[model samples]
Target: MALTLRHGVFMAPFHALEEDPTMCIHRDLELCEWLDRLGFDEAWIGEHHSAGFETIASPELFIAHAAAITQRLRFGTGVVSLPYHNPLMVANRLIQLDHQTRGRVMFGAGPGLLASDAMMLGIDPSTQRDRMLQALDVILRLFRGEVVTETTEWYTLVNARAHLLPYTRPHPEVSVASAVSPSGGRAAGRYDLSMLCVAAADGAAFDALAANWEIACRIAAEHGRSMDPARLRIVAPMHIAETREQARENVRFGFRKYIDYFNNNSPGRFPVPAGTDPVDWFVEKKLGVVGTPDDAIAMIERLQGQQGEFGVFLQQTHDWADWEGTKRSYELYARYVMPHFRGTNAARVASYQWVGENNVEFSGKRQAAVEAMFRKHEAEMARSGGGS
Candidate 1:
């Protein structure tokens, strides 16, 4: 089995749109609908509690809404911070969500980065590793329809049983968010789960992350299990257009707003390490992909070659308020970039080699389109009496 490249949504208010908190939820839903119509495979929302710029603290709640509106797109939490809440409750919610979405749900969990978030919840940042592991174990058990009766230092659940079972057999796919950490990758491999990495500003950073994933996969193999690169997902900011200059302009416009907000509000939150300017970091890291369709395709090819088979490329459109820019980018991507990567059997087969062992599955809409196209061809052939 080979993994195919699957398109996904990274629901976040990354640029100027972060300023208007209200737009965060609305924009994400709007994007979800757009992606659904555009034939994307997955829609992933993130969770961040009390981050000044992010309002998606309750990803499940938002994703539930997205699931309701869309008929086929798979919904995922880009990541839910696992250490901040009770795992039992989270597990129950996931079970409910899986049912609500009729098994089209993926769970991505992580130990959060922000100290402010951890402090607000009385979670010790230092103990996050242990807490995360404990929480993951608990959730996994609960999702498997087992009774979990346990008391951990951070949480207590006495004979907890999920009222609803996940729609996916066993459970929906589980992913771990790994950024600048081997721990997350290793943990994912140990549990036979998927790994999703966010490479902040550098291709090398992405390479490093991929190396860690490979190591994790090897470790899993040693344990009589295997890790599939096709199951690995990456999140990045993407802006595509017909011309490189146009794409650059669109990104620059969005970047200006993002830079202004960070400087004014959380000055040096993403501090330049000694001599590097933030802008340079952004370019070198490949945090934002702004280029012609061909250029964007080349970058994706480089990533696939270096990173191994990736299951999903979750693109975060800078922000929705910049509707024209976002629309242009996505339209170009759909018309030029996406088609190159989708539908064809050769493309699908190549995707597995580039992405990993899992076969890329189409969402219902895409499946229908493909079926209809075949039917049309069949009908035309019949009308011509099977003429060549």
Candidate 2:
């Protein structure tokens, strides 16, 4: 069987917090609606409680609202930051969402990133990963209808069971977030879940790409679970336009804002020199693909060639282009990019050519056969003395 790539977007929904709160959220919903109309596969909303620019605090709520506005587009929490909430509630809430969305939910769990958010919750950043693993373990058990009775430092559940099961055939697909880390891979392997590599475009993360999956597979072997490369997804930022120049010019507006947001909030992680061409900085950093639709296709194809089999290519969303430009990028992807990998458009073309080539010969033979039949009938009539 041939591998086909699925397209999705990973939206942090970044907007300056002071910006019109109403309009920001409305735009996020509109993004999902646009994706559904464009026949995209999925949209995963990010969760962040503290960061002023990274607005969406509850991705589940946003997913629920987006689910109503769109059809056939699956939604995920993007990473619910498992350490902050109780395991039972997380399990129950996700299961309920699966039912509500008719199984169109994919659970992507992670040890929350923002240290300030963890500090506010009184969670030690050092121990958060351990807590996340503990919570995820209990949640997985609860999902399987097994009663969980455990007392961890953060929370306790007494024989908790989820009577309300998921609508998906086993359960909605579960994924663990990895940022060039072995811990995320181990958790994914242990739970037999999908792996969502969040910073695939970052140079360091890209270097660790092959090693991370190897770690997951090794751990999975120890746990008697065979890892599937198709369950791995790599995410990157991209935008498409009519030409490279247009794409380069279009991303400058929000590209600068995006760089500024990071430098101001999480200093040193993404440092951009002042007054540099945003497009040059973008390309030099290997941050993402910004070119024509064909360029986007080549970017993904090259990644696949290097990384081997992976399931989905999730484009990171930023307000890089104006509204129409952003939507056109997605349209270009669905129109020119996706069909190439899926082999759908190529198949249609081949089928039409086959019909076109055979039709004339088929018609000519049928006409000759019909004429012969009439001639034979007329001859028989003349021989019987009934000829005109």
Among the numbered candidates, top lDDT falls to: 2
For candidate 2, the 10 contiguous residues with the lowest summed lDDT are 13-22
lDDT of 1 by residue, 102-122 (tens): 898999888876677888988
TM-score of each: 0.81, 0.89
The CA-based lDDT of model 1 is what?
A: 0.75
How displaced is residue 94 in candidate 1, in Å? 0.5
lDDT of 2 at 24: 87
- Error at 203, model 2, angstroms: 1.3
Q: Give the poorly placed runs of model 2, Cα more than 4 Å off.
A: 351-388
Q: Residue 193 deviation, candidate 2, in Å?
A: 0.4
Candidate 2 lDDT by residue in tens digits, 1-388: 6568888999987786457878889998998999999888988889998868778999999999999999999999898999989999999999999989999999999999889889999889999889889998988888888998889778878978998877886788999999877888989888898999988878788888888888899999999989888788889989899899999888875777877777776787676677777678777776788899888888787777767889899998888887888898999988988898778788789988997899899889999999999999989998999865
Clashes per candidate (backbone, < 3 Å):
11, 0
Cα lDDT computed for each candidate against the true fold:
0.75, 0.87
The lDDT of model 2 is 0.87
